[model samples]
Target: MGNVLGLESFYRRQLRQLLGIRHPRRISNAALYKRCNARPLRYRITKARWVLFGQVPRGSDRNPAFMQMARYFDSSTEGGW
Candidate 1:
């Protein structure tokens, strides 16, 4: 959770800097995202995670690494990453 918040904070700061937005000017995150035509960092991260996970199932069953991933996925508890 701390890492997620840190990444989001860094992302917002970089975007604000890129657009020359400074302390004096107040901007909502939604507005900032609209201006940049970008999604939130969390959404992007979630999408990337799903994409990677999707690839795991497509991997060859004969590969030891893929088999390990399969076992991990099957054994992992709910609410895990």
Candidate 2:
């Protein structure tokens, strides 16, 4: 079989490594996004969840989770740019 791994494969592998999921399985990206967005953050800004993550609504780069995922996703593309 030709290589079946692609972006979603990479994403799943990385997420499993980062989230430490024991079982490798199929998942819906939309579901993951919705669930993350729904979880109550500690705070908010202008009635937005970005504040819960201490971000300034599309103006901040302080989310640790975001930073980590960025590293995992982009590090290979540009040698971390």
Candidate 3:
């Protein structure tokens, strides 16, 4: 069991070293216990609106044609005539 544990730790350290990653700091059990006992925060998303915020629509003639088709289909389904 000891040999297996040692080999596992050794391999983990070797993999980290090869990947240039630092070992994380060890946290004490008491600190973990305190964190578990802390109160949780209440969060809510308020006053939110969606906005188009990506690359501009390509200037292809097909783009507007597809959009117009979609809008027409939606209006017909919604009884807008």
Q: Residue 61's C-alpha lDDT in candidate 1?
A: 99
Clash count (model 2, backbone only): 0
- TM-scores of the candidates are 0.73, 0.26, 0.28
Any runs in candidate 1 off by more than 4 Å, and if so which?
62-65, 72-81
Between candidates 2 and 3, the one scoring higher on TM-score is: 3
Full candidate order by TM-score, most accurate first: 1, 3, 2
Global lDDT of each model?
Answer: 0.85, 0.50, 0.43
Runs in model 3 with CA error above 4 Å?
Answer: 24-81
Ten-residue segment with the worst summed lDDT in candidate 1? Answer: 72-81
lDDT of 1 by residue, 1-81 (tens): 688889988898899999999999989989988999987778888899999778877888987868877666775566534
Which regions in candidate 2 have their CA more than 4 angstroms from the true location?
A: 1-5, 24-27, 33-81
Better of 1 and 3 by TM-score: 1
The candidate 2 region of ten consecutive residues with least summed lDDT is 38-47
Worst 10 residues of 3 by lDDT: 40-49
Q: How do the candidates rank by lDDT, highest first? A: 1, 2, 3
Each prediction's RMSD over C-alphas, in Å, is 4.8, 14.8, 14.8
